[model samples]
Each structure stands twice: as structure tokens, then as C-alpha cells.
Target: MFPLSTSINLTLPIEDPILKFLLILVIILAAPLILNKLKIPYLLGLIIAGAVIGPHGLNLVLRDSSIILSGTAGLLYIMFLSGLDMDMSDFKHNSWRSLVFGLYTFCVPLGLGILAGHYLLGFPLYSSILLAGLFASQTLIAYPIVSKLGIARDKSVTISVGGTVITDTLALLLLTIIVGMATGNVDDHFWWRLTLSVVLCIVVIAVLFPLLAHWFFKHVSDNISQYIFVLALVFLGAYLAQLAGLEPIIGAFLSGLALNRLIPRTSPLMNRIEFVGHAIFIPFFLIGVGMLIDYRAFFRDWESIEVAAVMILLITAAKYIAAFLTQKTFRLSKDQRTVIFGLSSAHVAATLAAVMVGYNVILGYTPEGEPIRLLNESVLNGTILMILATCTISTFATQRGAHNIAMGNAQESDDDRSRRPEEHILIPVANERSAEELVAMSIMLKKPRDPNGLYALNAIDNRVEDPNVEKRARKILDAAASAAAGSDIYLQTLLRYDVNISNAIVSVARERNITDIVMGMHHMTPAVPGIAGIPVPAGPAIGRMAADVLGHSNITTFLYNAEQPLSTVKRHLIVVPEKAEKEAGFQMWMNRIHQLARNSGAKIIVFAPASTMPYLRTFGRRRPANIDFVVFEQWDDLPSLEHDLRQDDCLWFVMSRRERVSYHPAMSRIPLYLEQYFAGYSYVLLYPVQAGPGDSRYL
Candidate 1:
């Protein structure tokens, strides 16, 4: 290590705006990284850094207006994200449990706080009620912890997020009413106004926001534009809530619930949302909270210590009891109980909001002329200490509980070693528009958390010696990779030169040991002059390159003709060949279609032979009864089914190569049929991997 410099060149509390921003950025970058190695939570490190560099500490940076602005945005951003990332399915499954837990966590602390304030600390009625409101509310300051750890969707975590909704809303409502009561604003008309305004707020957020978002997504495809639209909606909801007498964070979260289904977890847009929030807004807010700390107050006086100790004990104990009751009531495991407690115990967000409201509500004056506020300075100082201690506890407990749950899951996974082999999907992008759709579809088709499986390739013909060929190819592949990046999945991009592009594609597939190749449908080189005299056949339905790829390689491949966004599709129409159930890739292709259906909230409508019906049922037993099949054996009549392919329907036409298990003489005429009838519809022409020596290892 280099020796420390002896000379001191800088003065304390530097005030250059740019320099201060640069300093905060440096701290945000280094603090978490440096503390991560010591196995401490990086969040804890950020808070500590804020305290060290804040106005109360060394004063290297003042808690200025800019910091407050960014911090407020960060706080709102975090709340919005929690709503956006809520695992709705789990939350729905445990909805009642969430409500119960919400009441338990709320009522317990609230009661204790009221008693401690009125009897123990000897405060008045409304003042005690306000103090209880602070204890009753919590901020999910540690939610980012589980989200980063990849357990955000765990049942316990989902329930905790759901409970947050109930508890925080109730707590905030209580704060509003108590404040109105203290200020003599609570009356018959006041109740009527609050009720109507809240109902209107709920309706606007839950109903109007989704309708508006759907309209926007239908019209706008730009990722950046969509992100801005989402942010606009989040803040809009917050401001609307303020209009209806609620806090902005509540509005932010409600906005998330309304827009949940509109955003898929694997979408690039979701990735971008998380990336920007974590990188800037969330960190700024965390540091701002840290800057509020005055640790000296805890040591300088006994009243600060007394209030801090009592507040911390009451909240922690009450939260733990609530978690225990929820665990016993729901039959959750000890780890899950710990997780719930860890998540609900932290005091921030609504707690801070309550404190500020109470501190600002000056009712009268005391004998000594010190303002007799709802909550005095001692409690205000105690509130800061409570935030610091509770947040620290929240981080450590969440990390430990999540670790235990993850290790247990890993052990359970170890017992299933005979699961399907990993998948590596190869996508050959045609253009920017098609590439985004292809990548989005591929992301859903590929298994979640498949680290090394997604690859986007652009094969340039070496016959064209222009220097610009490679440049154009790189751009196409980069476009595909960008789509993947938004979803937080790495796309290994390849730009290769070969005399024959199809041959290059096949060679790359072999080198990568790729399992599936996705090719987009477009007019490439025309087919060879057809039938000496008869009118030359229209160009190949699926591109010549795509046909060559299907014929040259036996691996599974999909020829996609995407006419609209995958998110907009409403139904899947799967046309299975007669002997398709016997094909080696039958199960594999079925899994892909099922995964797509599940992700898109669509149902499968099958047109297959009656003999294939049992196998379809057996394969999709775990799925809901969303399938409706018809006996569609006559290949000659496939063209008449054009009436069945609606604008929102995706056709999955399964075919096979000559002499393959499911191959039929009619299958050879697929190109003529697709070009004749299916040009305007969205479809996937699927060719399952042909049965061969190693083909028995199906997914």
C-alpha cells in the first residue's frame, strides 16, 4: 500500500456544486463496494457514509436543496419500485394472510405506542395517538436487500410487500385524521370529504392509470420514451394522492399496483427501470436519510436516550410479536417469520412523515416559552436514532433470513439433478424492429437465470468485401443485445464473415452447442425458377436462409413473423401435426409455447389430431384448463383456418423435415401455403429437433 500524503491541501466543508456532486458519486460508488467484503450490508455503508460526510458530521457537504430533491425522488422511486416489482401471483395467493399480517403489525405497535405515550411518557390524547401512528407505520427500507438477493418473489417477501400496502395506508390515514382533530378540522363534512376523496383516488390510480398505460404501450415502442411515461405516471399518482389527502409515497405504490400486469418481469423496460432507480435515485435517498443523523444528541442528553430506547423497544418488540402471530396463523416456517419481521420492523417513510407532521403541528406554548408541539425536540431527536438503529437491524435480519431460505432452496434443487439440460438460444436478428420483438420473445422462451444461453448473431457474407459490411452487422447485433440488456440478461453477440451466411450460422450453432435458433421471417433471395414453364412461385414464405437453416440443422428452430408486440397478443393457436406427439422435440416445443402463454396471460387453442390430445393433456397437466382442441387432421384444409387467426392470435404451426417422425407429404408444401394465406398474421413456424443419437435428452 502507498503511504499516506503528509500535506493537507483541501479545506473543510467544500461547497463547489460540481465537486460536491462528484464527491457524493464517489462515496456512492466506493462505500458499498468496500463494505461488501466485510459481509456488512451495503445499505448500512451508504447511511454511515452520509453521516460521516453530512452537515452534522465533518460538513464536507451540506444537506442542501439539491440533495433533498434527489433524496425525495429516490424515496418515491423506491416506493414505486416495490409496487412495480411485487410478485402479484404470490400476493394474490396470500392476500388474506397479508391483510391479517397488516392488521397485526399495525394494531400491536399502535396500541403499545398509545399506552406508552399516555401512561408511561404522560403525553395527552391526540399527542399519544400521533405517537402511536408513527410506530404503526413502517418503511420497506430493506426491500432492496431481498430484491437484490433474488428473493423478492418469495412467499414471505411478497406477503410483506402486500402488508406494507395495508399498514402504511392505514397509518397515513390515521395521521391525517389525528392532525385534523388536533387542529379542530374534524367534522361531519370532513369525514364525507375524506371518504369521497379517497375512493376517487383509488379509482383513478387503479383504473385510469392502467387504461392510460395500455394506450401508451400500444402506441409507443421506444424503451426510453416508455420509461419516461412510467415515471410520469408514478409522480402523477403521487400528486393526485396529495390532492385526495394522502402522501405521495402511497400514490407511488398504488400506481405500481395498477400498472403491474402491463409490465413483464423479463422485459427490457423493467430492466431499465431498476437500473436507473438503483444507480441514482435510491442511493441519493439513502444518503440523505443518513445525513439527518446527529449521533451527538444521543450521547449529550438523557431524555434523547430515554425516548430513543422506549421507541426502539416498543417498535421492535411489537413488530416481532406481529410476525410470530402471522407465522403461527399462516403456518409459515421460522425463516419466513424472521423475514416478515425483518421487512416490517424498519421505521422510515411513513414514520418520518408522521414525525414531521407532528413536530410541525404547534398547538400552543409551554410555561418556559419553548413551543409546545405535538412531539417535542427530545422525541424529534429520538426519531433520528430510531431510524438509524431500526434500519441497521432490518438489514442484518433480512440478509440472514434470505440466506437461509436460499440455501434451503439450493438443497432442494440438488435433489432434482436429473432435470433438463441447460438451454442456449441463438437468435439471428433481421432488423431493429424485428430484433426487439425477437429478443423479447426469446427472453420469455429461455429459462429464467440462464446466464450463458442467450446469443444474438449477425453473419455477414465474406463474398461482399466492403469494409462497411462488418460495421452494419455489428449494429444489428448490438440492437439485439440492447433489447436483452434492458431485461438484465447478457446477450453474447457474434459478427462473423463467411462465404455462405447459412453455413456460417450452422457452424456457429455447432460451436456454441446451441439448443434452439430463432429466425425472423423476411424475403431473402428468391427461390430457384419453379416448374420450367408455370409462373415462378412467389419468394419462399420463410426466408431462403431460414429454410436452409431448418434443413441443414436438426435442432429445434422457430421462424417468427411478428406483426405486433408480443405483449399485445391475446391467444395462441397451436396447429400440431398428426404424428407430432411422437417427435423428439415435442415436449421441448410444448414447454416453450406453454411458457409464452403463461407469461402473456394467453390461452392455447390447439388444432391437432385426436390421437395427439392425450399427450397434450398429460404434458400440460400442471397448467390451468385454458386449452381447447379441435380434430384438425386434414392438412389440405389448413388454409381455410385463416378465419381462426385473429389479429391478436399467434399461430404455432408445427412441421417436420422429410422422413422425420412427424413428417407428412403435405408438410413439404408448407412454404406455398404460408406465403399464400398467412402473410398478414403473427405466427411461429416450429421445426422440432429431429430424433437422432443424442435427441432423447428432451426438456
Candidate 2:
């Protein structure tokens, strides 16, 4: 290895702010691709990059004020998101478990760290205690990976996240006391001030912030303004926490909890908040953490290596012990225990803060008359190494554990494996006025347990090059998305420029693996005579686009023509054709209808062959819905249901595509029949996609 002197002078520090920012951006962009290819977690890669470019390495970039500001913002953003993304309902339900895990995670690490610091490293009593607290605090750097895997709602993850709040709070509180004592201000007055200020701060953030946010959201009309308002609240909460003699992160976390209900998990506002934090703030903070490390310190001093090794070993052992005990107590799987350990193993934000505070304080004097620092450079370097090791371990452990858990869950139920194939529903928005109804229908039909979301498409004709057309299309889709958001449904807005709207819808549906397509019923206008003589009757039949989509798409499709709002409908009148129960998409349609009935609180009365009634009853029994069967005995007798159908009732026709097993000649006469006898009532015509031969089971 080259001498430290030569390495330190090899590179000049970059003084330009723009250059510094560009370097960081480049690192962020390139590190993930390279590290992912190498099978290294991108988060760990960032920290390594920070070390390489840090001042202690080649001295390329100094740790400047801008970096500090951005890093601080990022730290707060991570904490805020941790609280915001947590499933509040699950967290509350598992609060007691969280407390148990919190105590275990905190006490084990704190006890182990103190022993290592005092006996192994020969640190003073107060210094050992502070170091112990540092070891107890863990940053949830692996949470984003858990979320991306779509298992954030898992019981193990929920318990871990809940426990994080408790452990981190206790650690930070201990840090505050340590700092107060080291600075010679740990008096009764200090305790009183801290207690009162913290209590008041909690009340304001928990009670007042939510009240204010609720009022603001109710009054705020602009989506962008609403986003900005929430961001402002986050920082304001952080600032208030600082004023109350607590860390700003505490305020950010509390702020997230306060606004959790007001900002639905699937809302556009939540999307924007996460987008900004992940894209900018959090990355900057992570890079800042890297910049603090000096790679040369390890080579210059062997004591640094020993310190790092001890810290890592103690921290890892303590975390595992805690996880092991928790797993045994809760009877969790080995993978779940591993996941808890992984999620709680990383050391960052809180650890670094505590270390820095200790490093700055003057503890006592050495025997040689030199001032003894609470935390020396060796300890700091060791902490950096500890951060890297724990982060790598956490990433790998969490990834492996989460994957195993998911795979185990998938394997436990064959029915779930077959039925739950990422239910993505696509809705093509055509008429601005009816788009909301289409989206609402998609929401109702979507599998309640599915994590997949709805996609709202607005296809603009390629011939229309005007930007204004695309703008109008986006506005229509946005309105639909906003309507879905109100019901806590996640809807992704997609815009496409295609010559044929039907082709665009089909392409998007295939690309997104759309399980169901919901679209509004449109009527085709008659063609001029001789130019293009009416190929199909246009007056009462479906439009060309709707017909084309239905003909081309293999997925289940629903065409709705509502006489009144679906919410106002009092009853559902469903007519099922002969052999409909044998169709592959039968179960899917049945599930949709059951979900719709549940959502609308409408009583479902099905008219079908007596043979199909048993299957329908079995489905109702298994799924549990309010449905009644009426034996019609004939497919041609669907028009007879007009006598039972009321104006407020929704008439549903479970028809089949042409040449399908459930298709009947009477299916072609549905449009004409509806127009002649049931034009005043809301109606839905469903065409179940063709399923495989073996997919005809009742399950």
C-alpha cells in the first residue's frame, strides 16, 4: 500500500459547489447500476462512494455547509417517511409486540455495548453509557427494499417498524441525557424542562398538527399546494422538536403520524411526498454519511480496526439475541426472525449523531495532563466501519428473509398461487363525465387483498398533434384518478398517442398484465350512405372502439351504461347465460359481482339455469355475499327480467364472447333488448375472458 502522506496529497479538494453537486449526482446515478451488477446493495454502495470521495480519502471534496444542510434534510426525510409509510392500523394492533421487541433490541445492545466500551476498550463510565446508547439506535435503511417487494404490510415488517420508533426514541433520549451530563448541566431543572417541553411538543404535534392538516386539506383545492403544505408541516414539526430540546427527527416522525389519516397511503399527495424524498433528500443524506469516513484511518492505526471489529461483533450479536428471543416468544418463523434482525441491525443517523456529540464533549483529563475526549478519532473511524458492515449485513439479511417469507407464503396455498397473479385492472377513460364511474367500477371489481393498483389510460389519436388535446386527455384522466384517490384507491395515470384508442388500450393492458378492463359503453354514430354503409347497426349496439377492445382483449371486460350513479342504485339484477358457470373467467366475474354487491350494499338477484345456481350458491357460501338465485331455465327469457327490474336497479348481463363455451345466440340480442325494455335502468354487460380448460373449478 502507498504511504498515507502520498495518498492524502494526490487529489485536490473540489471547491466549486456545482462540481461537488455534479460529483454526488454522478455517484448516485452510477453507483447503483455498478453495485447491483456486483450483487452489492446500492445503499451500501452509496456509503462506500461517500468514503472514497470524502475528505479523509483523497481529500477530493470537503464536508461543506451545503452538504450538511442537504444531509440533515435527508436524515429528517428518512424518519418522516418511516412513520408515513407504516401501516398505522397494523402498527397499532402490534403495539405491544413492538414494545417487547423495542425493550429487547435496546437493552441487549446497550448492555453489550457498555461491556465492550468499558472492559474491552477501557472507556470511562459515562462515556461507556453514551456509547451503549449509540449502539442501541438503528436506522431502517432496508425498509425501502421491503416496500419495493410489496411486503411492507407483512406482520413481521409491521412489528419491526413499530419497534424502531420505541428503540430510537429511547436511544435519542439517552443521548440527550448523556450530553446534558457531560456538559455539566444534568440538574433537576434540566430534567423538568426536558419533560415539560417534550410533553408539550407531543401534544402540539399529535393533536394540533393533525387538526391543522385536516382543515388545510379540506380547504386546499390545488394538488401541488397540498403537497407543499404537507412538506412545510414536516419541517415545521422538525423545528418545533428542536425547540423542545429533542432531536428534529422525533418531530418529523410525529408529523408523519399526525397526517397519516389525512394523506391516504395511495393518494397522489403521498406519491409526491415519497418521490421528492427518495429522489433527492434521502440520497443526499446518505452521501453525506459516506463523506465522514476516512479510509486511510484503518491503515494508519490498528486500534481503529480492533475498535470497529468489537463494535460490529457486539452490535450484531446483541441484535441477533434480541431477534432470537422475540422469535421464540412470538413463535415466528426463522425467516421472520432473520428479517427483524436485518431491519434492526443498521447503524446510521442516530448513531452518528450520538457519536459526534460524545466526540465534541470533554470528559476528563488523562494521566499525562492531556484532555481526554469522550470519543476519540479511533472510535469515530470504528463507528464508520461499523456502519458499513451492519448496512451490508442488514441489506442481505433483509432481502433473503423477505424473499423466503414471500416464497413460503406462496407455497402454502395452491389456490392463492393460481388466483393471485398480481391483479392489475386497466380502465380506458374516454368520456370525461363517465370516467369517474368507470374507475369506481374498476375499484369495486379489484381484488381487495391485492397490492396491485389501477391504471387509468387516456389515449389521444395520433392524427391530433395539438398539445392541447393531450392536455385535455391528461386532465380527464387526472379527474378520474382524483376520484379514485378519495376512496383510498391507487390509480396510475397513463397517456398514450395512438392512431386507434382500442389498439392503445390493448397494448397497455398486455404490457401491464391487466386482469380486467372496465370501460364506459359508447354508441356508434351511423355512417353516411354509400361511403361506408352501416356495417353493423349503430343505434342500439356498442361503439366501434368498445367492440374492437372487447374483440381483441382476452382479459375480462365490463361495459357500463349507467342510467343513474352507481352509488344510488338499490339493487343488482344479473342475468347469466347457459353454461356460464363452465367458462374460465366465471370465478373472476363472480368475484367481481360479489365485490360490487358488497361495495354498493345492493342485493344481487341472479337469473340463470338451475345447474348454475348450485355453483353460485357455493361461491356465495365460500366468499360470503348477499346474493339470491332465480332459476330462469332459458337463455332467451332474459327480457322477462324487466318485470322485476326497477328504475333504480342495475341490470347486469353476464354474456360470453363469440365462439366461447357460454355464448348463446340470444347474446347478440342483448343491446336491442336493453334498449327496448330496460333503457331507463342502469346496465352492465360483462364478457369474461377465455380461461384455460382446467380453470372451470368452483374455487
What digit string (tens of lDDT, one per residue) describes model 1 on residues 388-461? 99999988888889889977876755664347767789998757778988988888787554545898988888
TM-score of every model versus the real structure: 0.85, 0.66
Best by lDDT: 1
Backbone clashes in model 1, listed as residue pairs: 268-486
Model 2, position 628, has a per-residue lDDT of: 80
What would the per-residue lDDT of candidate 2 be over residues 57-114, giving only the tens digit for each residue? 7677887898889989888887788777666655676789999999999999999989
In order, the Cα lDDT scores of the candidates are 0.82, 0.80
Can you tell me which runs of candidate 2 are displaced by over 4 Å? 1-11, 364-369, 407-417, 420-699
Q: How accurate is candidate 2 locally (lDDT)?
A: 0.80
Error of 1 at 506 (Å): 3.5
The best candidate by TM-score is: 1
